[model samples]
Target: MATTDTQPKRLPILTFCAGHMAVDWPHGAFWVLQPPIALAMGLSPSQMGLMVALTAVGATLSLLPAGMLSDHTRRRGPVFAGTFVWVVVGYGLASLAPDFWTLTLMLAIAGMGTSAWHPLATGTLTQTMAGQRARVLGIHAMGGTLAEVFAPLLTGVLLLYLDWREGLALAVIPAAVVGIIFFQARDRLTVETASAARLGDLKEMMQQWTSKTGLALVSMISIYNMAVMSVLAMATLYIVNDLGFSVFWGGVAFSAMILAGAVFQPIMGHLSDTMGRRKIFAISLFAAAPLGFAMPFIGSPWVAIGFLIVMIGAFYGVRSVVLASAVDFAGKREGTTLGLAFTLMDGVGALGAFLGGWAGDFDLAYAFALASGFAMISGTIALGSTLAFPKIQAEPAE
Candidate 1:
């Protein structure tokens, strides 16, 4: 946990963005790789479901303890570097996995590493300059979105030339290289820590999230995440199998979605600050519902790509705004709020993978319909909460 009173330097933000791009390189590939791995290993759809769910669940279960430990510890430099190292190790081990179970385990380990990233990075950025929270977070979110574009394109290319396991080894190299660089530049990136990152603050964390506004927003975010993650777990497979496209086309479609987010996330983040966050969030959810519902039926890959672009760009693009909203809700508990938000959103989101896989076992249309419905419900909840609360910043008591 780092701290600051004034505006933060740009180097640290760039460094975090670089690290984000590197780590998510492998993470973004996971979705693209799933279908091929399932085909090769003869896995059932539900078992395929376990791959993403367990990875997220592992991340979710481990987050609280890590979040607690990070709170009490003052040395964030090592924590940041260690996260990259953890990812490198996870991917390295994954490259050597002899079976599906081993591969899943390694991916889960990687998920744990990915889990620490947002809480550490977002907490620091949000604390650094209160005035620029949404924009900074948007830039940070953009880094992951860029990875979303690059990873599949790279992975899709790699699969044509190398063994899949060996291709996974490629992810380890860049991540480890970035980790070493971060270790060397750790001082420049460090921020001051607050006591809230304490090792025994479970009660405090619960108190912040238990309020009416908090519960409503969290529920909306959770359901929204479920819809997004479900699409992530299955979209590539749908494009490749249902639409009769090549693996490369699947990657292209996935990349299109991410590219849209990369381009629009910052703009939306900035917009959320000026417009009401609840309004932006609600609009995003509502706009995406119909797009998600129509994606599976589009038939043409190019047309389907348009659907994903709109959904990922317009619908799922509220990531930073929602995060800023959560920060507004947190007030003094920035670290605790970010950690809990990350954990709960992801933990609940993991269920979407399971549900998506289950539904996809039958028809992808069912999965898409489920996604559309969830999106509408999420938007509805956000709108109702906005009307009920009427205040964007529910600052906790001092």
Candidate 2:
């Protein structure tokens, strides 16, 4: 039997963070790539919407199963590592897609890989950090923020010299190396193991979800993810095609939104350690709500960039706090709980992606306004959730 390593805790955590950095690039890369691909293929807005929608659906399929495996094994390395292999294959094939649908299908397959990453990583990190889960997850999540910040901008740079297909191939290079490293190092990553998942495992997790706090968190996660993902999926397209910006500027806008979140992630996460998830969670949604309405009106490129930074940053920064709340509510079976929560959050959130596309067809401005409505709704729901379950526990966000 292979035993886990007793190295400095940061070693494995940093290693895993590296893998996240590798995988998340493609997700961010798509924002920049989508507009060019849509124009090149003459794809409709609905088709673009379908691409993101199907990709999200593909991820949803595996999320629950992967979560179950991670929870049962109490080891996230294998699952974490395996996700990138899928990414390599999927992105590699995606670069060669012959048509719009083919490219969409390839990306959808890759979504399965992307979907598997978070729960295992976040769950394992939550378990690993123990008392400091929120703070470190902020650190780990910063890796993804870096990816979101760079991926779009990098892709824009690549496209200046290469075709979209070649650009995608370049993106695959990082995942291949990371996959090999992660596969070799997987077993050594920290996780407290037990028997595999059983029927009772689902049952027990279900019981937790039924609680006021759990249910409320689920709502917050689902609604907020829907809102944010909608923006991510369309921001570049909206910027370039609708707002009349250059590809590089579109990428810049997308990165700005995430950059703000990245900058704030560590700060807010550390604060949440004493502030409590609820206050931080609610404040983020509330603060971010109006930015959605403001999105369509920002015409000046510099102004638009600044607005995106604040809006996306406000919501995106709250992710670690919300996730920490989920982990606390989950107690021990964090991988499983996170899986279920994200499936609900991201799976349902996928529809918003499609809606972003569809709404854009009618009017890009209206689509943004609709996204704003979701944000406002999410803020309201989060506030209501706090009121309903005031005793859920932890430091107050206020």
lDDT, candidate 2, residue 391?
47
For residues 262-366, could you state the per-residue lDDT of candidate 2 as single tens digits? 988888888878877767777777777676687677667667657667878887898787777777677777778778877876788888888888887876655
| List of clashing residue pairs for candidate 1 | 2-191, 2-192, 3-191, 3-192, 71-197
How would you encode candidate 1's per-residue C-alpha lDDT over 46-157 as one tens digit per residue? 6787788888878775566555544455556788898898888887888788787888888888778878877777777777777878889899988888888988888888
Worst 10 residues of 1 by lDDT: 1-10
TM-score of 2: 0.92
Q: After superposition, how far is residue 249 of candidate 2 from its true place, in Å?
A: 2.4
lDDT of 1: 0.77
Model 2 CA deviation exceeding 4 Å by range: 1-11, 74-76, 393-398
RMSD to the true structure for each prediction, in A, is: 3.1, 2.4
